[model samples]
Target: METVTTRTVEYPADGLTMVGHLALPAGTGRRPAVLIGPEGTGLNDFQRRRADALAELGYVALAFDLHGGRWFTDPQEMLERCLPLIADPERLRGIGHAALEVLRAQPRTDPGRIAAIGYGTGGAVVLELGRAAADLKAIGTVNALTTGRPGEAANIRCPVWAGVGSEDPIMSAAQRDAFTAELQDAGVDWRLTVYGGARHAFHHPPVDQSVVPGVAHHPRHARRAWHDVLALLAECLPVAAG
Candidate 1:
Protein backbone atom coordinates (compact mmCIF):
# COMPACT_ATOMS: atom_id res chain seq x y z
CA MET A 1 0.00 0.00 0.00
CA GLU A 2 1.19 3.52 -0.73
CA THR A 3 1.85 6.00 2.03
CA VAL A 4 -1.15 8.30 2.32
CA THR A 5 -1.39 11.58 4.23
CA THR A 6 -4.71 12.92 5.44
CA ARG A 7 -5.98 16.13 6.98
CA THR A 8 -9.13 17.96 7.96
CA VAL A 9 -9.95 21.12 6.03
CA GLU A 10 -12.55 23.75 6.85
CA TYR A 11 -14.39 25.86 4.29
CA PRO A 12 -17.56 27.90 4.09
CA ALA A 13 -20.61 26.48 2.32
CA ASP A 14 -24.35 26.84 2.58
CA GLY A 15 -23.95 29.54 5.20
CA LEU A 16 -22.12 27.15 7.50
CA THR A 17 -18.53 26.15 8.18
CA MET A 18 -17.94 22.87 6.40
CA VAL A 19 -15.21 20.52 7.56
CA GLY A 20 -13.85 18.04 5.02
CA HIS A 21 -11.26 15.29 5.02
CA LEU A 22 -8.54 15.54 2.38
CA ALA A 23 -6.28 12.62 1.49
CA LEU A 24 -3.13 12.87 -0.59
CA PRO A 25 -1.13 10.16 -2.30
CA ALA A 26 2.55 9.38 -1.63
CA GLY A 27 4.09 10.63 -4.84
CA THR A 28 5.02 14.17 -5.77
CA GLY A 29 3.47 16.39 -8.51
CA ARG A 30 -0.14 17.11 -9.33
CA ARG A 31 -2.49 14.12 -9.53
CA PRO A 32 -6.03 13.59 -10.73
CA ALA A 33 -8.45 14.50 -7.97
CA VAL A 34 -11.83 13.31 -6.81
CA LEU A 35 -14.55 14.96 -4.73
CA ILE A 36 -16.40 12.58 -2.42
CA GLY A 37 -19.76 13.51 -0.99
CA PRO A 38 -21.15 11.79 2.07
CA GLU A 39 -24.65 10.58 2.73
CA GLY A 40 -27.43 12.77 4.05
CA THR A 41 -26.46 11.84 7.60
CA GLY A 42 -23.24 13.78 6.96
CA LEU A 43 -19.51 13.17 6.73
CA ASN A 44 -18.67 10.23 8.97
CA ASP A 45 -15.77 7.83 9.39
CA PHE A 46 -16.93 5.78 6.46
CA GLN A 47 -16.49 8.67 4.03
CA ARG A 48 -13.17 9.77 5.53
CA ARG A 49 -11.90 6.24 5.09
CA ARG A 50 -13.06 6.35 1.49
CA ALA A 51 -10.88 9.41 0.88
CA ASP A 52 -7.93 7.58 2.39
CA ALA A 53 -8.56 4.58 0.18
CA LEU A 54 -8.63 6.78 -2.91
CA ALA A 55 -5.37 8.38 -1.88
CA GLU A 56 -3.83 4.93 -1.49
CA LEU A 57 -4.88 4.29 -5.07
CA GLY A 58 -2.80 7.34 -6.06
CA TYR A 59 -5.53 9.94 -6.41
CA VAL A 60 -5.99 13.18 -4.52
CA ALA A 61 -9.31 12.81 -2.76
CA LEU A 62 -11.43 15.02 -0.56
CA ALA A 63 -14.43 13.74 1.30
CA PHE A 64 -16.57 16.87 1.52
CA ASP A 65 -19.00 17.54 4.32
CA LEU A 66 -22.72 18.17 4.46
CA HIS A 67 -24.70 19.28 7.50
CA GLY A 68 -21.82 21.62 8.42
CA GLY A 69 -19.64 18.91 9.96
CA ARG A 70 -22.49 17.46 11.97
CA TRP A 71 -23.40 13.81 11.61
CA PHE A 72 -27.02 13.07 12.29
CA THR A 73 -27.81 9.71 13.81
CA ASP A 74 -31.52 10.20 13.81
CA PRO A 75 -33.24 9.48 10.52
CA GLN A 76 -35.94 12.07 10.98
CA GLU A 77 -33.44 14.79 11.75
CA MET A 78 -31.41 13.92 8.69
CA LEU A 79 -34.45 13.89 6.43
CA GLU A 80 -35.64 17.20 7.78
CA ARG A 81 -32.32 18.83 6.89
CA CYS A 82 -31.67 17.07 3.58
CA LEU A 83 -35.10 16.84 1.96
CA PRO A 84 -35.39 20.51 1.12
CA LEU A 85 -31.75 20.76 0.16
CA ILE A 86 -32.19 17.92 -2.26
CA ALA A 87 -35.27 19.50 -3.77
CA ASP A 88 -33.43 22.74 -4.46
CA PRO A 89 -30.91 22.39 -7.28
CA GLU A 90 -29.30 25.78 -6.70
CA ARG A 91 -28.55 24.96 -3.08
CA LEU A 92 -27.08 21.60 -4.04
CA ARG A 93 -24.96 23.30 -6.68
CA GLY A 94 -23.72 25.80 -4.11
CA ILE A 95 -22.59 23.02 -1.81
CA GLY A 96 -20.92 21.12 -4.64
CA HIS A 97 -19.18 24.18 -6.02
CA ALA A 98 -17.84 25.12 -2.60
CA ALA A 99 -16.39 21.66 -2.10
CA LEU A 100 -14.99 21.59 -5.65
CA GLU A 101 -13.18 24.84 -5.07
CA VAL A 102 -11.59 23.47 -1.91
CA LEU A 103 -10.47 20.33 -3.73
CA ARG A 104 -9.11 22.29 -6.66
CA ALA A 105 -7.15 24.66 -4.44
CA GLN A 106 -5.11 21.74 -3.06
CA PRO A 107 -1.47 21.83 -4.14
CA ARG A 108 -1.48 18.20 -5.25
CA THR A 109 -4.68 18.38 -7.26
CA ASP A 110 -4.87 18.38 -11.06
CA PRO A 111 -7.83 20.68 -11.32
CA GLY A 112 -8.49 19.91 -14.96
CA ARG A 113 -8.80 16.21 -14.28
CA ILE A 114 -11.42 15.68 -11.63
CA ALA A 115 -14.43 13.52 -10.93
CA ALA A 116 -17.26 13.75 -8.43
CA ILE A 117 -18.86 10.87 -6.56
CA GLY A 118 -21.46 10.93 -3.84
CA TYR A 119 -23.87 8.80 -1.90
CA GLY A 120 -27.55 9.48 -1.15
CA THR A 121 -28.14 13.19 -0.68
CA GLY A 122 -24.51 13.78 -1.33
CA GLY A 123 -24.95 12.01 -4.63
CA ALA A 124 -27.73 14.38 -5.49
CA VAL A 125 -25.34 17.26 -5.01
CA VAL A 126 -22.83 15.69 -7.38
CA LEU A 127 -25.53 15.43 -10.02
CA GLU A 128 -26.40 19.04 -9.53
CA LEU A 129 -22.79 19.92 -10.22
CA GLY A 130 -23.06 18.10 -13.50
CA ARG A 131 -26.25 19.93 -14.31
CA ALA A 132 -24.47 23.18 -13.61
CA ALA A 133 -21.85 22.20 -16.20
CA ALA A 134 -18.92 21.93 -13.85
CA ASP A 135 -15.66 20.73 -15.33
CA LEU A 136 -15.91 17.10 -14.30
CA LYS A 137 -14.36 14.16 -16.07
CA ALA A 138 -17.06 11.91 -14.78
CA ILE A 139 -19.90 11.71 -12.24
CA GLY A 140 -20.91 8.73 -10.16
CA THR A 141 -23.60 8.34 -7.54
CA VAL A 142 -24.99 5.64 -5.31
CA ASN A 143 -28.58 5.41 -4.13
CA ALA A 144 -29.23 8.93 -5.42
CA LEU A 145 -30.87 8.79 -8.78
CA THR A 146 -32.13 12.36 -8.57
CA THR A 147 -33.72 14.07 -11.57
CA GLY A 148 -32.75 17.62 -12.24
CA ARG A 149 -34.63 20.46 -13.95
CA PRO A 150 -35.63 19.78 -17.51
CA GLY A 151 -32.94 20.74 -20.04
CA GLU A 152 -30.37 21.31 -17.30
CA ALA A 153 -28.67 17.96 -17.87
CA ALA A 154 -27.72 19.15 -21.34
CA ASN A 155 -25.01 21.12 -19.63
CA ILE A 156 -23.29 17.98 -18.39
CA ARG A 157 -20.19 17.40 -20.44
CA CYS A 158 -19.00 14.06 -19.09
CA PRO A 159 -20.32 10.59 -18.71
CA VAL A 160 -22.43 9.71 -15.66
CA TRP A 161 -22.69 6.40 -13.84
CA ALA A 162 -25.26 5.65 -11.16
CA GLY A 163 -25.83 2.66 -8.86
CA VAL A 164 -28.95 1.81 -6.95
CA GLY A 165 -30.54 -1.02 -5.05
CA SER A 166 -33.33 -2.86 -6.79
CA GLU A 167 -35.48 -2.78 -3.68
CA ASP A 168 -35.10 0.86 -2.75
CA PRO A 169 -38.51 2.35 -2.23
CA ILE A 170 -37.25 5.92 -2.14
CA MET A 171 -35.76 5.52 -5.60
CA SER A 172 -38.44 3.50 -7.27
CA ALA A 173 -38.55 2.10 -10.79
CA ALA A 174 -40.46 5.14 -12.02
CA GLN A 175 -37.95 7.48 -10.48
CA ARG A 176 -35.07 5.61 -12.07
CA ASP A 177 -36.82 5.74 -15.41
CA ALA A 178 -37.27 9.48 -15.12
CA PHE A 179 -33.64 10.03 -14.23
CA THR A 180 -32.38 7.88 -17.11
CA ALA A 181 -34.80 9.50 -19.51
CA GLU A 182 -33.49 12.91 -18.68
CA LEU A 183 -29.94 11.79 -19.23
CA GLN A 184 -30.78 10.13 -22.51
CA ASP A 185 -32.74 13.09 -23.80
CA ALA A 186 -29.83 15.32 -22.93
CA GLY A 187 -27.51 13.11 -25.01
CA VAL A 188 -25.21 12.32 -22.16
CA ASP A 189 -23.33 9.06 -21.76
CA TRP A 190 -24.85 7.31 -18.78
CA ARG A 191 -25.08 3.91 -17.13
CA LEU A 192 -27.10 2.49 -14.28
CA THR A 193 -26.45 -0.66 -12.25
CA VAL A 194 -29.19 -2.17 -10.18
CA TYR A 195 -28.00 -4.29 -7.31
CA GLY A 196 -30.52 -7.04 -6.92
CA GLY A 197 -32.17 -7.65 -3.54
CA ALA A 198 -30.44 -4.69 -1.95
CA ARG A 199 -32.03 -1.75 -0.20
CA HIS A 200 -31.15 1.93 0.04
CA ALA A 201 -27.56 2.70 1.04
CA PHE A 202 -26.42 -0.82 0.21
CA HIS A 203 -22.91 0.47 -0.37
CA HIS A 204 -22.71 1.71 3.20
CA PRO A 205 -21.51 -0.57 5.95
CA PRO A 206 -23.91 -1.70 8.64
CA VAL A 207 -24.08 0.90 11.37
CA ASP A 208 -25.25 0.93 14.98
CA GLN A 209 -26.84 4.31 14.47
CA SER A 210 -30.52 4.75 13.76
CA VAL A 211 -31.53 4.59 10.09
CA VAL A 212 -34.61 4.98 8.00
CA PRO A 213 -36.71 1.96 7.16
CA GLY A 214 -35.55 -0.03 4.11
CA VAL A 215 -31.99 1.17 4.58
CA ALA A 216 -29.54 -1.72 4.98
CA HIS A 217 -26.01 -2.59 4.05
CA HIS A 218 -25.16 -5.38 1.66
CA PRO A 219 -21.52 -6.33 2.03
CA ARG A 220 -21.23 -8.12 -1.28
CA HIS A 221 -22.95 -5.36 -3.19
CA ALA A 222 -20.92 -2.77 -1.38
CA ARG A 223 -17.67 -4.30 -2.57
CA ARG A 224 -19.01 -4.57 -6.09
CA ALA A 225 -20.15 -0.98 -6.09
CA TRP A 226 -16.72 0.16 -4.95
CA HIS A 227 -15.14 -1.81 -7.75
CA ASP A 228 -17.48 -0.23 -10.27
CA VAL A 229 -16.74 3.30 -9.07
CA LEU A 230 -13.00 2.60 -9.20
CA ALA A 231 -13.35 1.36 -12.72
CA LEU A 232 -15.17 4.52 -13.66
CA LEU A 233 -12.37 6.61 -12.21
CA ALA A 234 -9.69 4.53 -13.86
CA GLU A 235 -11.33 5.04 -17.20
CA CYS A 236 -12.31 8.70 -16.88
CA LEU A 237 -9.85 10.41 -14.48
CA PRO A 238 -6.90 8.05 -14.13
CA VAL A 239 -3.80 9.22 -12.26
CA ALA A 240 -0.77 9.33 -14.49
CA ALA A 241 1.81 6.59 -14.02
CA GLY A 242 5.04 7.65 -12.38
Candidate 2:
Protein backbone atom coordinates (compact mmCIF):
# COMPACT_ATOMS: atom_id res chain seq x y z
CA MET A 1 0.00 0.00 0.00
CA GLU A 2 1.17 3.51 -0.68
CA THR A 3 2.19 5.54 2.35
CA VAL A 4 -0.08 8.47 3.18
CA THR A 5 0.43 11.49 5.36
CA THR A 6 -2.36 13.50 7.01
CA ARG A 7 -2.71 16.64 9.05
CA THR A 8 -5.35 18.83 10.62
CA VAL A 9 -5.91 22.13 8.84
CA GLU A 10 -7.76 25.20 10.08
CA TYR A 11 -9.65 27.38 7.65
CA PRO A 12 -12.52 29.87 7.67
CA ALA A 13 -16.06 28.93 6.74
CA ASP A 14 -19.65 29.62 7.81
CA GLY A 15 -18.49 32.38 10.13
CA LEU A 16 -16.47 29.90 12.08
CA THR A 17 -12.89 28.66 12.13
CA MET A 18 -13.41 25.42 10.30
CA VAL A 19 -10.94 22.61 10.90
CA GLY A 20 -10.36 20.05 8.14
CA HIS A 21 -8.18 17.03 7.50
CA LEU A 22 -5.78 17.00 4.57
CA ALA A 23 -4.25 13.79 3.27
CA LEU A 24 -1.47 13.50 0.73
CA PRO A 25 -0.15 10.56 -1.25
CA ALA A 26 3.48 9.52 -1.15
CA GLY A 27 5.66 11.94 -3.18
CA THR A 28 5.71 15.68 -3.73
CA GLY A 29 4.43 16.07 -7.27
CA ARG A 30 1.06 17.51 -8.16
CA ARG A 31 -1.83 15.06 -8.43
CA PRO A 32 -5.55 14.90 -8.91
CA ALA A 33 -7.36 15.94 -5.75
CA VAL A 34 -10.77 15.47 -4.15
CA LEU A 35 -12.72 17.58 -1.69
CA ILE A 36 -14.63 15.32 0.69
CA GLY A 37 -17.73 16.42 2.56
CA PRO A 38 -19.18 14.60 5.54
CA GLU A 39 -22.70 13.95 6.78
CA GLY A 40 -24.86 16.36 8.77
CA THR A 41 -23.18 15.38 12.01
CA GLY A 42 -19.99 16.94 10.71
CA LEU A 43 -16.54 15.64 9.82
CA ASN A 44 -15.63 12.57 11.82
CA ASP A 45 -13.23 9.64 11.66
CA PHE A 46 -15.22 7.98 8.88
CA GLN A 47 -14.81 10.97 6.57
CA ARG A 48 -11.17 11.36 7.58
CA ARG A 49 -10.53 7.72 6.78
CA ARG A 50 -12.15 8.21 3.40
CA ALA A 51 -9.74 11.02 2.69
CA ASP A 52 -6.85 8.82 3.75
CA ALA A 53 -8.05 6.04 1.50
CA LEU A 54 -8.20 8.45 -1.45
CA ALA A 55 -4.71 9.63 -0.63
CA GLU A 56 -3.47 6.04 -0.58
CA LEU A 57 -4.82 5.76 -4.10
CA GLY A 58 -2.50 8.62 -5.17
CA TYR A 59 -5.06 11.44 -4.91
CA VAL A 60 -4.55 14.38 -2.66
CA ALA A 61 -7.72 14.49 -0.55
CA LEU A 62 -9.18 16.82 1.97
CA ALA A 63 -12.18 16.04 4.18
CA PHE A 64 -13.65 19.49 4.61
CA ASP A 65 -15.29 20.62 7.82
CA LEU A 66 -18.97 21.55 8.05
CA HIS A 67 -19.57 22.58 11.66
CA GLY A 68 -16.29 24.22 12.44
CA GLY A 69 -14.14 21.64 14.32
CA ARG A 70 -16.91 20.15 16.42
CA TRP A 71 -18.92 17.08 15.48
CA PHE A 72 -22.46 16.61 16.74
CA THR A 73 -23.19 13.39 18.54
CA ASP A 74 -26.66 14.66 19.27
CA PRO A 75 -29.04 14.21 16.42
CA GLN A 76 -31.11 17.25 17.29
CA GLU A 77 -28.10 19.55 17.29
CA MET A 78 -26.98 18.26 13.95
CA LEU A 79 -30.41 18.78 12.47
CA GLU A 80 -30.67 22.23 13.97
CA ARG A 81 -27.50 23.30 12.24
CA CYS A 82 -27.77 21.30 9.03
CA LEU A 83 -31.42 22.06 8.28
CA PRO A 84 -30.78 25.78 8.04
CA LEU A 85 -27.53 25.36 6.16
CA ILE A 86 -29.06 23.06 3.61
CA ALA A 87 -31.96 25.44 3.07
CA ASP A 88 -29.63 28.27 2.21
CA PRO A 89 -27.78 27.58 -1.03
CA GLU A 90 -25.58 30.62 -0.59
CA ARG A 91 -24.42 29.42 2.80
CA LEU A 92 -23.68 25.97 1.46
CA ARG A 93 -21.76 27.51 -1.41
CA GLY A 94 -19.78 29.65 0.99
CA ILE A 95 -18.75 26.66 3.07
CA GLY A 96 -17.88 24.57 0.02
CA HIS A 97 -15.94 27.34 -1.72
CA ALA A 98 -13.86 27.92 1.38
CA ALA A 99 -12.88 24.28 1.46
CA LEU A 100 -12.35 24.18 -2.29
CA GLU A 101 -10.04 27.14 -2.06
CA VAL A 102 -8.12 25.36 0.66
CA LEU A 103 -7.73 22.28 -1.51
CA ARG A 104 -6.81 24.26 -4.61
CA ALA A 105 -4.15 26.19 -2.71
CA GLN A 106 -2.38 22.99 -1.73
CA PRO A 107 0.98 22.37 -3.40
CA ARG A 108 0.15 18.73 -4.21
CA THR A 109 -3.23 19.45 -5.78
CA ASP A 110 -3.74 19.84 -9.54
CA PRO A 111 -6.33 22.58 -9.12
CA GLY A 112 -7.94 22.02 -12.48
CA ARG A 113 -8.26 18.28 -11.90
CA ILE A 114 -10.36 18.31 -8.76
CA ALA A 115 -13.54 16.45 -7.83
CA ALA A 116 -16.06 16.93 -5.02
CA ILE A 117 -17.80 14.12 -3.12
CA GLY A 118 -20.03 14.44 -0.12
CA TYR A 119 -22.35 12.49 2.16
CA GLY A 120 -25.73 13.70 3.50
CA THR A 121 -25.66 17.45 4.15
CA GLY A 122 -22.13 17.52 2.90
CA GLY A 123 -23.55 15.97 -0.22
CA ALA A 124 -25.85 18.96 -0.63
CA VAL A 125 -22.89 21.29 -0.23
CA VAL A 126 -20.98 19.61 -3.08
CA LEU A 127 -24.10 19.76 -5.23
CA GLU A 128 -24.35 23.45 -4.50
CA LEU A 129 -20.75 23.83 -5.58
CA GLY A 130 -21.58 22.20 -8.89
CA ARG A 131 -24.64 24.42 -9.30
CA ALA A 132 -22.37 27.38 -8.69
CA ALA A 133 -20.22 26.05 -11.54
CA ALA A 134 -16.91 25.53 -9.82
CA ASP A 135 -14.27 24.15 -12.17
CA LEU A 136 -14.39 20.47 -11.29
CA LYS A 137 -13.67 17.19 -13.01
CA ALA A 138 -16.70 15.53 -11.42
CA ILE A 139 -19.23 15.76 -8.60
CA GLY A 140 -20.63 12.90 -6.51
CA THR A 141 -23.09 12.88 -3.63
CA VAL A 142 -24.73 10.30 -1.35
CA ASN A 143 -28.00 10.62 0.55
CA ALA A 144 -28.49 14.12 -0.82
CA LEU A 145 -30.64 14.20 -3.90
CA THR A 146 -31.21 17.91 -3.63
CA THR A 147 -32.68 20.11 -6.36
CA GLY A 148 -30.85 23.23 -7.35
CA ARG A 149 -32.38 26.70 -7.81
CA PRO A 150 -34.29 27.17 -11.05
CA GLY A 151 -31.90 27.14 -13.97
CA GLU A 152 -28.96 27.24 -11.60
CA ALA A 153 -27.89 23.68 -12.42
CA ALA A 154 -27.15 24.78 -15.98
CA ASN A 155 -23.97 26.28 -14.63
CA ILE A 156 -22.50 22.87 -13.91
CA ARG A 157 -19.75 22.00 -16.33
CA CYS A 158 -18.94 18.44 -15.26
CA PRO A 159 -20.65 15.13 -14.87
CA VAL A 160 -22.44 14.38 -11.59
CA TRP A 161 -23.35 11.12 -9.84
CA ALA A 162 -25.63 10.76 -6.81
CA GLY A 163 -26.29 7.68 -4.68
CA VAL A 164 -29.18 7.25 -2.31
CA GLY A 165 -31.08 4.52 -0.54
CA SER A 166 -34.45 3.53 -1.94
CA GLU A 167 -36.00 3.71 1.51
CA ASP A 168 -34.62 7.08 2.43
CA PRO A 169 -37.47 9.35 3.44
CA ILE A 170 -35.50 12.51 2.87
CA MET A 171 -34.75 11.60 -0.71
CA SER A 172 -38.04 10.08 -1.81
CA ALA A 173 -39.13 9.37 -5.37
CA ALA A 174 -40.56 12.83 -5.87
CA GLN A 175 -37.39 14.45 -4.62
CA ARG A 176 -35.35 12.27 -6.93
CA ASP A 177 -37.59 13.24 -9.82
CA ALA A 178 -37.14 16.92 -9.09
CA PHE A 179 -33.39 16.51 -8.80
CA THR A 180 -33.18 14.62 -12.06
CA ALA A 181 -35.43 17.11 -13.77
CA GLU A 182 -33.22 19.99 -12.74
CA LEU A 183 -30.13 18.22 -14.04
CA GLN A 184 -31.89 17.26 -17.23
CA ASP A 185 -33.16 20.73 -17.94
CA ALA A 186 -29.66 22.04 -17.35
CA GLY A 187 -28.30 19.55 -19.88
CA VAL A 188 -25.84 18.25 -17.32
CA ASP A 189 -24.66 14.68 -17.48
CA TRP A 190 -25.93 13.16 -14.25
CA ARG A 191 -26.87 9.74 -12.92
CA LEU A 192 -28.60 8.45 -9.81
CA THR A 193 -28.17 5.11 -8.06
CA VAL A 194 -30.75 3.84 -5.62
CA TYR A 195 -29.58 1.08 -3.34
CA GLY A 196 -32.42 -1.31 -2.61
CA GLY A 197 -33.73 -1.57 0.96
CA ALA A 198 -31.16 0.89 2.24
CA ARG A 199 -32.16 3.86 4.35
CA HIS A 200 -30.72 7.30 4.90
CA ALA A 201 -27.07 7.29 5.91
CA PHE A 202 -26.76 3.70 4.73
CA HIS A 203 -23.12 4.31 3.84
CA HIS A 204 -22.24 5.17 7.40
CA PRO A 205 -20.94 2.63 9.91
CA PRO A 206 -22.92 2.01 13.06
CA VAL A 207 -20.97 4.15 15.43
CA ASP A 208 -22.95 7.10 16.68
CA GLN A 209 -26.19 5.74 17.99
CA SER A 210 -27.86 9.12 18.36
CA VAL A 211 -28.99 9.57 14.81
CA VAL A 212 -32.11 11.00 13.22
CA PRO A 213 -35.07 8.70 12.72
CA GLY A 214 -34.72 7.19 9.24
CA VAL A 215 -31.00 6.68 9.40
CA ALA A 216 -29.57 3.17 9.25
CA HIS A 217 -26.34 1.52 8.21
CA HIS A 218 -26.15 -1.17 5.57
CA PRO A 219 -22.61 -2.46 5.58
CA ARG A 220 -22.88 -4.14 2.22
CA HIS A 221 -24.37 -1.10 0.52
CA ALA A 222 -21.78 1.10 2.19
CA ARG A 223 -18.95 -0.90 0.68
CA ARG A 224 -20.67 -0.99 -2.67
CA ALA A 225 -21.22 2.75 -2.64
CA TRP A 226 -17.57 3.31 -1.79
CA HIS A 227 -16.55 1.21 -4.75
CA ASP A 228 -18.92 3.11 -7.00
CA VAL A 229 -17.61 6.46 -5.83
CA LEU A 230 -14.06 5.25 -6.46
CA ALA A 231 -15.07 4.20 -9.94
CA LEU A 232 -16.55 7.64 -10.53
CA LEU A 233 -13.34 9.25 -9.37
CA ALA A 234 -11.23 6.94 -11.50
CA GLU A 235 -13.27 7.81 -14.54
CA CYS A 236 -13.14 11.55 -13.93
CA LEU A 237 -9.83 12.18 -12.17
CA PRO A 238 -7.66 9.15 -13.07
CA VAL A 239 -4.80 9.45 -10.62
CA ALA A 240 -1.74 7.34 -11.38
CA ALA A 241 -0.67 4.47 -9.13
CA GLY A 242 1.93 5.47 -6.59
Q: Which numbered prediction scores highest in lDDT against the true structure?
A: 1
Name model 2 segments beyond 4 Å from true: none
In angstroms, the error of model 2 at 137 is 0.4
Candidate models: Cα lDDT each? 0.94, 0.93
**Over all chains combined, what TM-score does candidate 1 have?**
0.97
lDDT (10s digit) by residue, model 1, range 90-113: 999999999999999999998899
lDDT of candidate 2 over 1-242, digit per residue (tens):
44899999999999999999999999889999999999998999989999999999999999999998989888888889999999999999999999999999999999889999999999999999999989999999999998878889999999999999999998999999999999998999998999999999999998666446778899999999999999999998899632
Residue 183 shift from truth in candidate 1, angstroms: 0.1
Alpha-carbon runs more than 4 Å astray in model 1: 209-211
TM-score of 2: 0.97
Task: Give per-model TM-scores.
Answer: 0.97, 0.97
For candidate 2, give the lDDT of residue 111.
84
